[model samples]
Target: MYDFEYVKPGSLDAAKSAIAGAEDGKLMAGGMTLIPTLKQRLASPSDVVDLGGLGDLAGIRKDGNSIVIGAMTRHAEVAASADVKAAIPALADLAEGIGDPQVRNRGTIGGSIANNDPAADYPAALVALGATVRTTKRELAAEDFFTGMFETALEDDEIITEVVFPTAEKAAYAKFPNPASRYAIVGVFVAKGGDGVKVAVTGAGPAVFRVAEMETALSGNFSADALQGISVSADDLNSDIHAGADYRAHLVGVMAQRAVKAAG
Candidate 1:
């Protein structure tokens, strides 16, 4: 890794100041992705602002009907949180299923959403469960938060503070993962929340996208059978060595069915 100044901020305010004041400073959360990128010389920032010291930025809380997850909270924390399990077990399950124990313990939800890896798992839950991303500057609905691959609505210096996920009637996530990376080749999150039925797809296309057709069908009847008629086209989906667009297209339906069944 290239030489860089490191700052472990004790408070959210300090972390934001460190990021905003520096020329090319980057926030370091779990470092599951960022550290690898730095090692590969993919990103060479002047400073690394570590958020680990900000104890206030970690943990899970129940906010009435919604579950609030702190920005620096790790996947393992989410997976183990009794409040999350009781409220949205599917989301907890999703976190538990993320890249094994080490990755779960190291990866943070804030980091995952900010980075917006195409194959990452959390975005699907965010979108499907109608979660709201609260940041230092403003709150963003998941619908507006994730824009594209490795991108989000956050400005360079902005930092996420909390993620608010509303309770759902039923929800589940299923992913066909790459053996090595444990990234979803095509993951689907299905939810039947009081807000209505929501279906979000990840690990396909350039980013996590909603399957409107499936959502419409599932809305009327939340079942695996409702997903049978719908089929994702291969044209716009991702194509890679582990699985091509065609294969992923098929998995979209299969995974959708699995998610539906799991949600039930």
Candidate 2:
């Protein structure tokens, strides 16, 4: 790994200030992705600002109709939270299925969404559940926050503080994960809420996206059978050794069906 200064701030304000002052600064939450990138010499920031010391940035609590999770909250905490399981069992299930024991224990939801890996799982739940990402500077909808593969709407100086997820009337997630890494090859999240039905897919394209046709159908009839004739086009999907574009597209439909059935 390339040489760089490390700063572990004790508070949110201090963390932001430390990053803002650096020429090229990168924030480390769980360091799941960042550490590997740094070790490979892919990223050489002037400073690595660790957010772990900020005690307030980790926890899960219910906020009226929503579940508010702090940015530094780890995957294991989300998976094991009584509040999360009671309010949104599907979300807890999704967290439990993230990586292995180690990854689940060490990876943070904020870090996962911030990195915005195409195959990452949190984006799907966020989009389908209509979650809000609260940063140091501003708040953005999950759909608006994830701009593209490994990209987000966050400013260089901004740090995510928390995520607010509205509890859905019905929600479930299903994915065809890569056996080795446990990353979704084609993951789908289905939900029915005040906003209506939402079907979000991840790992099939350059970024997480919703299926409008499936959503419309599921809105009318919340069942796996409602998705009988719907299809996902492979035209703009990712094709790698693990799975081809057409196969991934096919998995979208299959996984969506599974998600819908699970939601029921």
Candidate 3:
């Protein structure tokens, strides 16, 4: 890792200040992706501000009809939280399926969404659930929050505080994971909520995107069979050594069907 000053602030305000004051600052939440990148010399920020000490930034709670998950809340916490399981079991299931034990225990929701890895799981959940991302500066809709590959709409020094997800009538996520990394090669999160049906897809393109045709189909009939002919085009999907764009496109349809069935 490149030599850099490390700051673990005790309060949220201090953490913001620490990052704002540095010429090149990076926030560390659980350090799952950041740590590895630093060690590999892919990133060389002048300061690394660890957000682990901010205790208030971790937990799960229900607010009216929505589930609020603190940004610093670990994946394992979400997976094991009674509120999450009872309110959004699919989210809990998705969290439980993230990586292995070590990654689950250490990776934070904020970091995962912020990193916006093309293959990350949380983005699909956020988009499909119509979640709101609450940040230190302001609140953003999930669709607006994730802009592109490995990118977000967050400003420099703006910190995510929590994510608020409106409880869905039914929701589920299904993925074709890379066997070793467990990252989704093609993951789909399907939801039928107050607003109607939503089908968000991840790990198939440059970033998480919705399948309008599938959503429309499921809206008319909330069943796996409803998605019989709906499929996303393979033209823009990622095609790595693990899987081709056509295969990923095929998985999108398969996974979306699986997600709908799981939601039921």
Which of candidates 1 and 2 reaches a greater TM-score? Answer: 2
lDDT of 2: 0.96
Candidate 3's TM-score: 0.99
Query: Candidate 1: which pairs clash?
Result: none
lDDT of 1 by residue, 93-164 (tens): 999989989999899999999999999999999999999999999999998999998889999999999999
Those runs of model 3 whose alpha carbons end farther than 4 Å from true positions after fitting are none
Measured against the true structure, the TM-scores of the candidates, in listed sequence, are 0.98, 0.99, 0.99
Tens digit of per-residue lDDT, candidate 3, span 153-215: 999899999999999999999999999999999999999999899999999999999999888
Clashing pairs in 2: none
Which wins on TM-score, candidate 1 or candidate 3?
3
lDDT of 1 at 248: 92
Q: In model 2, which runs have C-alpha deviations exceeding 4 angstroms?
A: none
For 141-255, candidate 2 gives per-residue lDDT tens digits of 9999999989999999999999999999999999999999999999999999989999999999999999999999998889999899899899999999999999998999999
**Which RMSD values do the candidates have, in order?**
0.8, 0.6, 0.6
Q: What ordering of candidates by lDDT runs from best to worst?
A: 3, 2, 1
